[model samples]
Target chain A: MNIRTIITGLLLLTALICPALAAKELSGQEILDKSQKLNEADSRAASMEMKLIDKDGEVSKREVRFWSKGEDKRLIKFLSPADVKGVGFLILNADSDDEMMYLYLPAFKKIRRISGSAKSGSFMGSDFSYDEIGSTGYNDDYKAERLDDENGQFKLKLSRKDKSDAEYEQLIMWVSQEAFVPTRVEMYKEKKRSGKAYLELRKVMTAEKITKTGKYWMPFSITMEDVKKGHKTVLTMSNVKVDDDVPDDYFTQRYLQR
Target chain B: MKRDKPILCLCLLLSLGLILSLAAPTLAAASINGEIKLDERAYADGSSNQISWNRAEFKLKVASELSGQAAGYAELKLRTADGPDVSSLADLASKSKVSAYSLELREAYIDIFGFPLSNLDIRAGKQRIAWGTADKLNPTDNLNPYDFTDFLDFGEKIPTNAMKLTGYFDNTTLTLASLPVFTPAAMPSTFDSSINGYINAYLPAGMTLVSSESQLTLPNATLGNSMYALKLARTIWGQDISISYFKGYDSVPNLSNLTLTAVSATQMASALTMTYPEIQVLGYDLAGSFNDIGYWLEVASFTPDQADQTVISPAGTTTTEVGQYTKYTVGWDYTFTYDIYVNQQWMHGFFDERGSTLSDFLITRIEKKVMDDDVLLALNWLAEYNNGVVGNMFGPKVSFYPADATEIELGGFNITGAAGSTLSTWANLDQVYLRFKYSF
Candidate 1:
C-alpha cells in the first residue's frame, strides 16, 4: 500500500474516533496554540535510558543525556559504547517540518551532517526511527483535527501534509480538559499498530506567570510500547532547569563536536 | 485408463488439501525506497560521454511471518532503465541480470523458527549468506562479488541459491550452507569479451560461475553443479570481539600439459584445451571494537586441484610447484566525528612462491558530511605498486538531498599507470554515476 494512503486513512480514522471539539469550537490555530503552550513554556535537560525488546525477546538498550533549551532545540549525547562516549548530536529547527542536525564522531574527530534518507532511519539502531524524534515540532507539517471531549479533555488527531515527512500514518493525542496539555499520543504507521506512548507528570516544581497556569505540569517522563512486539522504550526527564538562557551558537556543529 | 484417471483426480485433491492445511497466515511489512542522481565526469580516455536519466530502483515488498513454526517472505523489484536487455553497469555487476524494467522475485525463503531445538534455526530455499569479516570487500561476499559502483542493492539481487542451517546460542552463531546446484558465470569485469575469448582467456575449464557473464546468452554449461560452505562465529570479551572461520568450494581453471609434438597443427590458439580443477578456499576472520576504534583482519588461502604446469598465455607455461596461494588484508576503522569515518587498510599476497605474483595493495579513505545534513562528500585514494608494475586510482563522490528523505549522489573515478611500466600512463576513464534514492 502507498505510504501516503496509509497516513491519510489512519489520521481520518483517528479524527472520527476522537470528536474534535474545543471551548469555542476553536479554529485549528487556537487548538494548536493551546497545545503549544505546554511544550514551549518549559525546557529542561535530562538523562534517559531506553530499551527495546523485540518480539523474539531480543533486547537492545541505549542511554542518552539530552540537553534541551526550548521546544525545538536539543542536544543528545551517547554515554555507552565507551569508544563513542563523547559522540553527540545537536538538533535545531531550520524551518517548519525541517530540522538541521550534526553528529560528532569522536573517532573521526569531526562533526558531520547526516543528509537525506538517513534521517528516516533508526537512531543508533533503536526501534525509534530518527525522523520521529528529529521532527518533534509538528505545527508546520500537520493539519490538526480537534475531536470531541471526553471527561472534559480535548482530543485531537493530526494528519501529515506530505508523505515524505515520516513513516507514521497519524498521531492521536489526548489533552486535558482544563490544562490543555497532551497526556498521551498513539502513533500508527501503515494502519498497523506501531507504538503507543503515555506521558506522566511527576510534579510541577514551579510555574512562571507568563501564561497558562493549568499547563504547569510538564510531562517529566514518557513510556512507549510497540503494539505488535514485546518491546518498550521509556524516557525520563530530569535536571529540570529551564530558561537558562542558552545561546543559539551553542547548538552549532562546532560546539557539538567539542 | 479409467482407473488411472480416478487415481489422478484423487491425488490432485489430496495435494491441494495438504497445501491448504499447511498454509499459515503471516505478518508482512513493506517499504518504498528509491534514489536519484546528478553526475559529472571527464574520462581519462574521453570515449562515450552522455549525461541523462540514471533511472531509479523502485521496489515493492510483501513479507509475511506465519503463526506456525514456519515463515517466508518475497519481494518484487523494478528499475527505470529502458530496453529489453540493456544491463545497468551496477545491475550487471550485481547478480541481477534481468532488465531493469523487468520485474523479478527478489527473495523467497521458508524457515522453521523453533525446530528440533529452540536455538537451532533451519531455513531452506533461496537465501543470501554473508561470510568473512571485511565490510565492503568481504571475500565471503563471495556468494556474489559486488560492484562497489552500485549501491548496496547487490544483496537484493544476487542472493545465493542454497539452504542454510544456523544455530544461535548465547551470542554465538554457527551456520552451514549446502548448494545442491551451482552454475558457473563470468565476473562483470569480463563482460566485454567474446565467449570464445572468455572461455580461452578468463575462465578455467573445471570451475562453474555462479552467474552468466553475457547479457545476450544463456548459460548452458554446468560443472561441479554442487557446492557447500560452513561458517562459525562467536562473540567474546563482552561482545566487543568476534572471530569466524569459513570454508567453501570454488572453481579454478587448469590445463593438462601436452608436448608441442603431441598437438595437431590445427590447434592454433586452441592448441591446448583448458580443464577446470576443483578449487577450494579456507578463510579466517577476526574483528574487534574497542571504545571508538574497530579493527578487522581476514586471510584466505586458495588450494588448486593439483600442482602442475599451467599456461596463463599461449606463449609460456608456469609450473605450479607451489601447492597453495594465500591473500590477507588487515584494516582499522575509527570514528572521530559523530558522523565522519576513516579507514586504513593493507593487503599482501603470500603465494606459494611459485604461483603468479599479485602485488601488494594499500587503501585509505576519509569520509565526512557537510551542508546542513543535505550534502555528503567523500575522497578516497588507492595505490598498488606491484613488483615492477604500479597502478593508482583516485575517486571523489558527493551526495545531496533536496528533500529531507531522498538522496542523489554523483561520483567519478580515475585510473593511471601502465600495466607493465610505472612510467607509462594508461589513464582509463570510468563512467560517472548518478544515483537517487527514496526510502520508507
Candidate 2:
C-alpha cells in the first residue's frame, strides 16, 4: 500500500473512535448533578436509628423520626432514649441567604433558636456535623472537576466556591459509573491534598433496601466513618414514605412545640 | 372543709380519667405517656432529710377532626406528689393508701387549629404558657405561677385557666390571652429561725421578736380581677424579636398589713400578710447569633399601683408599701466541641426608688458529654455581687444512662453568703441530691 493512502486511512479511523470515547466520558459536575437529582424528593418521612461508636468501641443508639419537604425545610424529632425523647429540631432555609434553625427540649417545653455558626458543630454527638446533614445541593456551593477514571468508577474533586460558607475546604468523591451513586467521600480542611487524604471515609455501606419511587432512588441505610477520630455512625432508615401529602404548618415553631 | 376539698376534687378527676381512658379508642388518635421521678436529699447540717417519690405524672393527648376545616386537640395531665407529714390530710390526699394514689389535674387544655380564619389558632383551658428569649430566668414570663417549695424544681410552672388566641401573618405572630383565675406563687411556710432572731436583734429596745407569719391573699375569680396580655413576635434581620404587654396581679406578693402586738413583757408577736396587687408590665426580648455564640436579651418594666416600702418604728410596729421596678437579663451560649457546651448570663434588677436591696446576679453553666453521650457532667454557679452582701451557689451534677428508658443523676448543691445575705438563709439546707427517672 502507498504511504499517503495508509496515512489518510489511519486519520479516518482515529476520528471515528474519538467521538465515541468523548461520548462516554462525563464531567464531574454532570456526575454530581445526576447523583443529587436521584436523592432529592418532594416530601419524605423516615424513621431512623443512629448508632454512634467511639474509639473505645462503646456504642450509643438514638432513634428519631425525620421529615423533609423540598430542599430547605427539615424536621427531626427524637423518639427513643428517655433522656432525649421528644426533643425536636427544625431547619428552614429561606429564599434569602440566611437559614433558620430551632431546637425544642421537652424538659423545658420551650423552643430555642440555634445560631447559624453552629453548623460546624457535631450533630447530636455523632460523627456527622450539622453542616453535613444540612447540605442539600453541591452545585451551588462547590466547584467540581473530574480527577480520574478507575475500576468502573469516576473520581471527582470538589472545592468550595465560597470559602467561608463551609467548614470543609474540599471533598473527594468516588462515584459509580453505572448507578451514579457516591461510593465514598473524603473530606479535607485544606484546598490542596499534600500526600494522602486528610480525613478519609474508609468504609461506606449503601442501602440494600432502597425503593425506586417515581424518578428518585431512595436509600434506607448509610454508614459514615471519621477516620481521624476513630468514630463511626451507622444510620438505618425504615418506614420511609415519599411524595406523601405534607402540611406546610408542620415546619412551623408551633408544630415544633407540639 | 378545706381539707376535704382536695379529696373531693381528686375523686372527680379519677372519674374523669376513667371516662377518658374508656373513650380514647374512639378518637382519631390518642396517646398516653408520662414519667415518674424519685428524689432524695441529705442535708449537710442534718437539720432536715427528705425522701419522696417526687413526681408521678401521666399525660393524655387526643386529636380529632372537627366540623369544616377545624381540628380539635385535648391534652390532660394527672400528677401526684408526696407531701410533707404522711398523716396530714394534704399528704394523704396526694398518696392515698386505699386508692393507691390521689391525682391532681395539672392540665386540661383544648386547642382548636384552623379556626374560622386560616391563620388563627385558639386554645382554652387550664394551661401553662411561657414567653421569653432568655433561658430559665425569663422576665417576660408572668402568665403562670411557680411552686418554689422545692427550690431545685425550677422548670415547673403552675397551669392557669386561660384562653389564648394567636394570629399568624406572613412572618409575624400576634397572641392575645385572658387569664380568668389567679394563681399565686407558693413558698415554704417555714424558714431559718436564726435569721428571724438576727432581724429582731436589730430592732429597738423592748421590741422583742416572738414570731412572724406570712399569709397569701389571692384575687377572687371575677371578671374585674382577670388578667390579660398581648404579645407580638417576628423574625427580622436574622433575629427573633418580641414585645409583650401584661396587665395582671403580681405572682409574687408584697408584705402588707403588718401588725406587731405585745404578747408579754419580753416577747412580741409580728404578723406579716402577703397580698397580690394589680400591676402592669412591658417587656421586650431579642435573640440572635454571631459566629458561634448564641445571645439573648430580655427586659421588663413593671409598674405597680403603689410603690412598696417598709417602715420600722421603735414600738415594734412595721409597715410596707409596694412599687415599680425594672428587670433585665443578657445571656450567651457556645459549644466548644462535639460534647462541650457553656452558657453564661447576667441579670439586673433596678427599682425606681433608691436602696431597694435588689442585687445583680451572674450565672454560668458548663456541660460535657462522654462515653458517646451516655454520661453527662454539668456544673452550674450563680453569684450575687452588686449588693453589699455577697451570695453564691454552686451545683455540680453527673448523670448516667444505663438504658434508653432510665436515667440517674447524682448532684450536690452548696450555698454560701454573708450573714444578712439572701443565700445565707438557706445555707443550712445545702444538701446532696440523687434523682432517678423512668419514662414510658
Candidate 3:
C-alpha cells in the first residue's frame, strides 16, 4: 500500500508543476525588453572598428573607442585616421524630452550641438544612422507585436509609436530565444501620398559573434547596410569592459572636447 | 624695451613648461604625438602669378600625467614659409632679413583636476581658454589674440599666457581666468596698405599718416594690466546657456598717440603712437539643437574706456570719440540626406570691426561627401554689407582623402564688390590654393 500510494502521489504532483515550469512563450514586448536589458550597464568601455564598404566594395576602416555610462549617456571617440583623430560624439538622456547630443570635430576645434532629429543622418559617413548607433532598444520607441516563431527565434514587428518622430516607420526583428538578443533587423520607411501609406524596407542590420559578459549579452560584430545607397558599415567590437568606472561627467560637452 | 619684456616673460614661462615637461616623474607617464603639413598657393591677381604662399608646418603635442590628480600638456610648433618679412615684427624697424623659418611654443599648460576641492580644476601657464558655444566666429571669445598673419588660415588664435580655474557643479560649470600678458592681433603683409588709412582716419586734417614702418604700442605685462574673465554656464532644456564678462584691452589696434610737426599751415608730418584701446566686454551665448537644426547665438557688448582719438595740430586739438559698439553672431547647421551638410551664420560685427557703426556679414558653407567619404566637395561664401555697399567672396573646394591620414585639397576664392568698400580693397586678391596634409 505504501509504494503504490507514494508513486501515484508523486506522479500527480509532477503533472501539476511541470506545466507551470515550462517555457512561458514570451510576448514581443517582453522579448524586446529582455534583449534591451542585456545591453544595459552602469558603465561600459569598448574599442571598436568600423569598416565602410562602398558600392564598388572598397573598404576603408576607422578605429574608435566607445564609453557609456548609466542608461542615458554614451561617448564614442575616433582614435585613427589622421583627419578625424580626437573627434568625439556624446549623447545623453536618450528618448527623453531633455535629451542632449554633441559632436566634437578636432579640425574645427569646436563642439557642435546635435538635434534629436539628426538621428536620421548617417554617423561619421557610415551607413549606420545616428539612431541606429544608439544602444537604446525598441521597447520605448516602438509598439511590438509577436509573430510566428521560426528557426529557434521569435519574430516581432515593431511600429514606431510616433511615426513622425523617427526616421524609420517600422522594424522587423528576429530575436534569439536562448540569448534574448536581436540577430537581425529590417528597417522600413513609410511613404504617404494621396491618402495612401505604404512601408518600404530601406535598411538592414545583422549581428554576429554574440557573447556573454558576466550577465550581459553583446554582439561583437554587426553590419548595417543601406539598400538604395548600396553602402554598408561593418562594426566589430573588442576589449569590452562591462560595468567599468566612467566619470559622471564623461558624457558632457566639456569632455567631448577632450 | 617694453616689447622685449613680454618676450622675456613668455620665455620664462616656456622654460618653466619645459621643466615641468621634463620632470622625471611626469616623463615616466608621457605620450607624444606629432604631425607635419605642407601648403602651397597662387593668386590670380599677382603680376607674375607667382606662388602667393608656400608653407610647411610641424606640430608636436606631449601629454603627461604629473600624478594621480594632475596632468600637463605641451604643443610646440615649427614652421617655414615664404613671406615678405613675417615671423617677427622687428623687421619693421631693423629691416631684418625675412625670418622664413621659425619655432614657437603654441600651448603649454598644467591641469590640476579636483585641486583644492572635489569639483574644481586649475590650469596654469601659456594656454588657450575657449569661452563660447558658437562656431569659430564667437563674439565672446576675446581671451586669445587673433592670429591674422595668414588671413587665409582664418579662425586661428595665438595662445596667450594665462591661468584658468574651473568649477564643476551638477549640470553647471563656472570658469575664471587671468591673462597677464596682453597680446595684440597679428596681421598679414597686405595689412600694411590698410594701416595708413586706419591711422589717417584718426589724425587731424593737416597730418597725413605714414608708411609700412608703423609699430604697435603693446601694454606691458603686469598684474594691474592683466585681462580677467569670468563665465558661468549651465544646461537648460538640453541647451548650453552662458553669461561671460571680459575686462581687458582690445586686441584690435587703434591709434593712441601721434607725433607731428608742422610742415605748413594746413599740412603736417606724422609719426606713430600705435596702441590698442581698453575695453570691457559683456557677453552672452546659447547653443543647442532643436529638431534637426543645430543653432547658436553669441553676443558681446563693448564699452571702450579709451575710445577717443586726440590729435594736436596747428589749427587746434581734435578729440573724436569712437563710442561703444556691439557684436553678435547667430548661426545654424543641418545635414540632409545623401551627406549634404550646410552651415550658415549671420554676424553683426566682424572680428576686427569696431566703433558705433559696424558692418554686417553673412557666411555660409555647404559640403557634400561621396565615394564612402573619400571625396568631399565644399562651397564657401562670405558676403559683407557695409552701410550701403555690398561685397561677396565665394569659393569652391574639393578635398580628396587618398589614404588614412592623407588629404589633398584644391580651392579658390573669387572676390567681387562695388567700388569703395572695405572688402573691395581685396577685390584683386582672388586666389587659388592647394594643400597637402598627413597626420600621425
Chain A TM-scores of each predicted structure, in the order given, are 0.70, 0.81, 0.87
Provide DockQ values for all models, in the order shown. Answer: 0.02, 0.42, 0.48
lDDT of 2 at A237: 81
DockQ of 3: 0.48
Clashing pairs in 3: none
lDDT of 3 at A57: 85
Candidate achieving higher lDDT, 1 or 2: 2
Residue range B2-77, candidate 3, lDDT tens digits: 3354465468559757876667564667766678888888887758687878889888777777565887888787
Residue A86 Cα positional deviation in candidate 1, in Å, after optimal superposition: 27
Tens-digit lDDT string for candidate 2 (B1-440): 43565577667768757967777665444444566666766775555565423455555544444343444444455555454436556656653432343444566677777576888888888777788888888878888886666667653577788999988887899999999878887655343454365456555586677777656677898999899999999999978999999999877666555555567777777665557767898999999877658899999888876435443444554444445678888999887745478889897752212224466888899998886566899999988775588889999999987766678999988999887666776676678878888776
Q: Runs in model 1 with CA error above 4 Å?
A: A1-258, B1-44, B50-56, B79-104, B140-157, B189-225, B238-248, B251-268, B271-277, B306-309, B312-322, B349-356, B421-427
Interface RMSD of each candidate, angstroms, one decimal = 17.1, 2.5, 2.4
By DockQ, the candidates rank as 3, 2, 1
Who wins the DockQ comparison?
A: 3
DockQ of 1: 0.02
- Any runs in candidate 3 off by more than 4 Å, and if so which? A1-25, A55-57, A105-110, A191-200, B1-29, B66-68, B83-99, B199-215, B257-268, B311-318
Backbone collision count in every prediction?
42, 6, 0
What shift in Å separates residue A140 of candidate 1 from its native position after superposition?
39
Question: Ten-residue segment with the worst summed lDDT in candidate 2 chain B?
Answer: B349-358
The numbered model that scores best in TM-score is: 3
Model 1 agreement with the true structure over B1-440: per-residue lDDT tens digits: 32254355456457635644555331222212222232233343465564323455555433344454666654445454433343466545532244334343455567776567866767777665555554444443344323322321221225546787776665466767776654343333323332344344433443333333222222123444456667666645522223333333332233334222213323322334334434566777776544325567777766755535544433455555546777777788764533576777776651212245656667788777653334778877667767867777777888785543456778876777655532123244344666666543
